[model samples]
Target: MTGLSPVFPEAVLWDMDGTLLDTEPIWDEAMDALAARHGVPMTPQLRRATLGNNSVDALTKVYDAARLPESGRDFDADEAWMVAMVVKLFARELPWRPGAVALLDLVAAAEIPMVLVTNTMREVADIAIETIGAHRFVATVCGDEVAVGKPAPDIYLRAAEIVGAAPGDCLAIEDSPTGAAAAHAAGVPNLVVPSQIPVAAASKRVFRQTLAGLTVDDLARLFAQARTDTPA
Candidate 1:
């Protein structure tokens, strides 16, 4: 078993996408299908731009890039379609990142108040929680549930509020630059686990660590060590 120093936070906030679930690949496939159906190229840059954004934000980015005629279309409809496609794809391939379940169980057993903070819609978030059996979270905050999404701090701040913890007292676990930035802006210390995107240097400097497959016991030990290591 790997050793952890036992550094614990009053509460923890989790990022949903690549961090907990290996849904990025499914997203890519669905995006490709959507682009093909719409006769628009799903370029690499376009995909990267939408990586950590909400469904509506991503669809807006795509719509702007493809220059599709408005057709008096409701943006929400396009977003719903994309989310529906993703839901169908994920139902067939319920992917979870390595160590996600173990880590979640460990934290839950420790009775650490946990909340899910994601750029996904509330509907998509619910599906993910059910798929991963992560419904134990005290609450879940989605981009669509907030006034703004990642890199805006609104979601993280709201999560902190719901958890009854100061942002500084909560630990935010993220895998994307946008999500990490959001946590940092909310005054929450973040731990990053790189996924579809690399953690930027600035984020690296601020994050507690780039996790390397930590278990619940490992986290408890880490928190203990952190307490000891922290200056009195």
Candidate 2:
């Protein structure tokens, strides 16, 4: 890894699912299996709409598509089922986004604090953190840990607080519109790295940069360049 200039932000906040781990497809496959078991057909459109949302939101989307009556039954049971399915799927394979670990380590080595800000529940986030061996990362703040999930500034703000950085001084790396919006609402500069799902045009306008395939070395170089351009 190339040495990056120390011009990086005081802290960096990360989005978990598509941003760090390639768990989106795993979620899709598990959801599909769940739908199949229930004799409901899962469609790509339905899956896409639920991208980046919490499990409850995703399950509600699936339930709506199947026209399942909103029975006052404990929906938490369904969430638990979904979580178990995801855990089983992950046991078979845990994919990480390219250069994710490298980039995170680069930032860490630069002495910049980092926190995971995810809409995933704390239990799920803990699993992911353990799978990724995320001890090197500073902290993780899950949606369940906050009052609200993404599209609201609460989670991001909580993450910033954990990292002890003001929103303006922190950079948020996100892969979805809802996540990007949350970062924007939190007043943090965002960088979008689009995944299998598309980002909205309105959301795209707020980001400081859009990366095609950023590597750890690339981020290091960016900071290095920034530092070089700064006057002594």
Candidate 3:
């Protein structure tokens, strides 16, 4: 841990899947299994294309790739199957992405408020939180809880409001381009820790190899720097 700085982000928002938990692989596997059960194949290309979408959106992409039905009973059945598969995996082990626990612990210790801002629905997110420890967050902003999901900024905006922070004052920890885009669009400073996907840096984004070994000093330092660089 590094020395605490006088400056602190009003709140820190986190993306739950690949950012905090290594569940993207489980998502990939479940999507593949769903395809296999329906006599369709989930190729690597297809999986990569829909890496960060919610269950329903992912189903749309997968079904399209399979040339299968995308709505009504077909979509619902496939979505249910995928969720069940991943939920079982999550129950067995909600694997933490590298350095996630340490960062969470340190930030919490510093008395910085934290919240889960994720595109994953509340039900599925709740399942993972059991192992992750629900007390880590003051609140969780799920995809279903917002009007729109990531890449749109509704969830992050809502999370900031819930935490009593201004969107511009909050720092978002993200793991993918989709999430980075969402955070940036919301006018929040985001620290991207690449997980299953490598997040590319853009005007409103910053990237780190991993959250491993990062200290509150690191966060404060980065937040301080971004606050200066951020546009009004």
Candidate 4:
């Protein structure tokens, strides 16, 4: 894990899938179901490719792996089915990552604004917000709403905009390489706490095995060490 200072940022951007919630397994479940329908097992390589990908992108990877004729209609059916599966799972239970709630509480207490940045579509992102408690964030940026998805930084940049902060003034907490890369690309420093998938180290970010026991004091320190200036 990289070291950080004790200063809190002007705002914080949260990643939904693996960072705030333990929903990656639910996503994997949906993907596996899709693969089974195509007569293919959810192999390791295929699973890796889907990590941090938008839902449609994940389905496309499965389609390519199964060599299915990805007619538009066929893709729509599969995507809707996967979305339904995930919605059902969310209805059953909302799994929060360790310390996710506590960290959110801390941020809320500090009165610092936050934004949700996720690759999930808006409808599903709504479910996540409800389950996690909607009052925590000032804005939510979903995959379908952005021109590009994770690793492209469009969603994150939009999130920063929604929160009325420059990218350099926001702190992003992410759980995957794609989310981290997106935040980094948007000129936001991030704290990467890997969930089901591991995230690699990069400039202007910190990595941890988990967010357990993290406090505002810790975040302040991390932000202090993080670079505040983004290249133009």
Best lDDT among the predictions, by candidate number: 4
State which candidate, 2 or 3, has the greater TM-score: 3
Q: Judged by lDDT against the true structure, how good is candidate 4?
A: 0.83
TM-score of each predicted structure versus truth: 0.83, 0.82, 0.89, 0.91
Which candidate number maximizes TM-score? 4
Candidate 1 C-alpha lDDT tens digits along 13-96? 889888888888888898787677667889998888778887666777777777777773468777778878877876776777
Candidate 1 structure, TM-score to reference: 0.83
- Candidate 2 TM-score versus the reference: 0.82
Q: How many backbone overlaps does candidate 2 show?
A: 0
Please report how far candidate 1 places residue 7 from its true position, in Å: 4.4
Q: Say what the RMSD of model 1 is.
A: 4.6
What range of 10 consecutive residues in model 1 has the weakest lDDT sum?
223-232
lDDT of 4 by residue, 73-179 (tens): 38677778877878888886878899899999998998889888899988777888898877788888899899989888899889888878888878899988788
Instruction: Tell me the whole-model lDDT of each prediction, alpha carbons only.
Output: 0.76, 0.73, 0.81, 0.83
Instruction: Compare candidates 1 and 2 on lDDT and give the better one.
Output: 1
Identify the runs in model 1 with alpha carbons over 4 angstroms from their true place. 1-7, 69-73, 203-212, 215-232
Note each model's CA RMSD in angstroms: 4.6, 5.5, 3.2, 3.7
Alpha-carbon shift of residue 1 in model 1 (angstroms): 23
User: What lDDT score is found at residue 224 in candidate 1?
Assistant: 42
**Model 4 TM-score?**
0.91
The residue pairs found clashing in candidate 2 are none
